[model samples]
Target: MTLVNNPSRTARAGVPRQARAGRPPRLSGRRLAPYLFILPAVVLFAVFKLYPIGWSFVLSLFKTVGGVDTFVGGENYSRLLQDPLFWTALKNTAIILVVQVPVMLALATGLAVAFDSTLLKGRSVFRLGFFLPMVTGLVAYGIVFSVLLNEEHGLVNWALSLVGVDHVPWLTDPLWAKVSLGIALTWHYTGYNAVILLARLQTIPRELYDAASVDGAGAWGAFRHVTLPGLRPAILLTTVLSTIGTLQIFDEPYVLTRGGPDNATLTIGVYLYQNAFVFFDFGYASAIAYALAVLIGILGLIQFRVLGDKK
Candidate 1:
């Protein structure tokens, strides 16, 4: 005799045979294990990040004077619009972004390619030297650059003097101060971008370049058709990261130039700090913070749409 298990019979019984046969039950906690593991991180983010941002908005609605606060609707934002110093800060920051980002990324891409090349010698030592600026203290970096860019005694001006050019005022003149700030930004971030691009470069298979060469493509063609397309994502990443940092730049301008030479290097972040800590105008500072956030968000979206890998 042959025995058959019928689902119809099991349906009539109102429970599957496996359930009736004393199969072990799954604990609810076991099902929730993953959520439990991430709960702490979620709570911390909500408390520290989300709460502070929300509070800043609330603070922006109030008028604060000498450590006292009174309700004042939209006054801080109104004041931000009329502030000339804020406008100056914004203009200086835009100049830095326009000039520094492209130059830094170009140098970074070149360094990445050089490091990845088999013909390059002392590659490890070169990488270490490139990376040394990043891990060092930001204030220390600013101080060293300040001394090295001084008008008369600086090594940079001395080097130029050797070529029959007179000493250039790196921090004393308005135009040169902005230019010097751009140079400092480029030097600080080029290696960081190089490391990121190099990591991306390593992942690209060599077969693509080989195929390009076989197709009679020369060095420039190989880079254009193969390397650039593959590096698109990394370029976008570094660009967006650099944009955010540039928009929020403070320590370098503050330490090196003190936003001086007639406010040539006062960025939004440095100005925001000045409003909050220096002037003690918490309400206006909060409004400035919000404005900076909105600007960053808009620029970030533009970069994504323009440079995204889809087309």
Candidate 2:
């Protein structure tokens, strides 16, 4: 009888009451902790991002005047189609996107590749100099560039005179105004692209380079065969980002030219701002904003498809 009693005691001690077969394990503390930590960030994102997007979409369907709203379905979009200024802005943005992104990416890629070379000296200084324009405040830099590009007495013309080139009307002429904006944007962001490409370059395995060298591959051959493939993803990323940035270009044009010289520098973003803040057409502006989002999404998809095909 004592043995039987002791056996029951041993069995009871072998397993706790909580681990009995009839009940499932409790997850109240363990599973809830992670979600509790992330709840604040989720709330903030919903408040800031999703809320604004929804509000913008709703506003786009209405005609707002003096803080009063009236539902006017699709009228704002119809105005966009009819407006010559909107078309002009779209044309200008397309021109810049076509011309500037390629040039900037090419230059940045060259700079990144050059900087990555072991043959180069003073790499750090060159990198720093290239990145300086980006660090300068946007408005301040725009103001200074406007001064520098002044037609009559600016530093650019002054330097041009030394080389027997005549003064160019950078801000006044439509063609020159667009070119000046492209130059300023390229100058400001090339270093940023270089830094991005350079980081990607570092990840490329050195063994590939060594193997290429052993097989009598010159620098160009190695880069073409190895580096180019390695850099494709980064190139796609920078291209897409630069395209978006150029499409939304406002500050440089706003501060430097105010979309002047016959609205040659006007982008979709500036056009939207002109409608909303300048003309006090909030509904139209909201429509313009949504249109831009759609444009970006479509273009981004095209880019992704093309890049995917190439890969």
Candidate 3:
């Protein structure tokens, strides 16, 4: 007996009619649905994010004169090299970055460990109390801190007087102004970092800890061998984020000190805002912005190199 294969049967058996005919199959609505759903997001990103970034780079290369933009090539960047105020702002920013990031992350790590402990009572309440500061508005918190740290008649100074100690200049003296900014930053973001670390901590397997215990490891040994390795990614994440945030710090210094006490707290971000909005020197502002972006990128790379997983 002779058997013949039917085209319809072949097409129905997981072979497309288009494929059999040597033509590409058309994309069905199901396949196209994801792209269609994401199209709006893609369009929004291009218009709002990408377009503005590209325009800013172009704007950096041009100088505005008589309400018209004139192309000046790399002059704005060159000017930044010689600008005394720019260097001062950069120095202040560097100080904050060097001092604040480590202190905040260290505090956050300790908080995370405490929050993760089974022996801790009322964990939820304690966690919420610590995390509440993250939800507070930046300006609101800054203003509150400014009021509390006021040189005369502030609650802090009033309390200090009761203790027979002199009123510490929290936001007035240049050094104290930076210290005050650091304190505000630590309060605001330590909880945020702690939450990130806690989440990562939960993801670590209990079996690993038990195994370490069975192997005669103490709490510190388990933490050093198991916990630290497990927490590397989260630690790196918090470090990078803290570094970036400190580098671009603005609202705190702006509302608290206004980059004051002789420009002690003037960050690159505040200086950029001053150039853009105050001086209306958009070109210089854009240059400052791009310079900041480059600095952030470099620091990010250095962090990755130092902290990223090798295996």
| Order by TM-score, highest first | 3, 1, 2
How many Å off is the CA of 110 in candidate 1? 0.9
User: Where is model 3 more than 4 Å wrong at Cα?
Assistant: 4-26
Residue pairs with clashing backbones, model 2: none
**lDDT (Cα) of model 3:** 0.94
lDDT of 3 at 293: 95
Best by lDDT: 3
TM-score each candidate: 0.89, 0.88, 0.93
Model 3 residue 236 CA deviation (Å) reads 0.9
Against the reference, the lDDT scores of all candidates come to: 0.91, 0.91, 0.94
lDDT of 1 by residue, 224-265 (tens): 999888999999999999999999999999988999888988
Q: Residue 111 in candidate 3 has what lDDT? A: 92
- Candidate 2 residue-wise lDDT, 128-161, digit = tens: 9999898999899999999999999799999999
Per-residue lDDT over 1-311 for candidate 3, one digit per residue giving the tens place of the 0 to 100 score: 99999997876789787987899999999999999999999999999999999999999999999999999999999999999999999999999888888999988988998999999999999999999999999999999999999989789999999989899999999999999999999999999999999999989999999999999999999989998889999999999999888888899999998999899999999999999999999999999999999999999999999999887
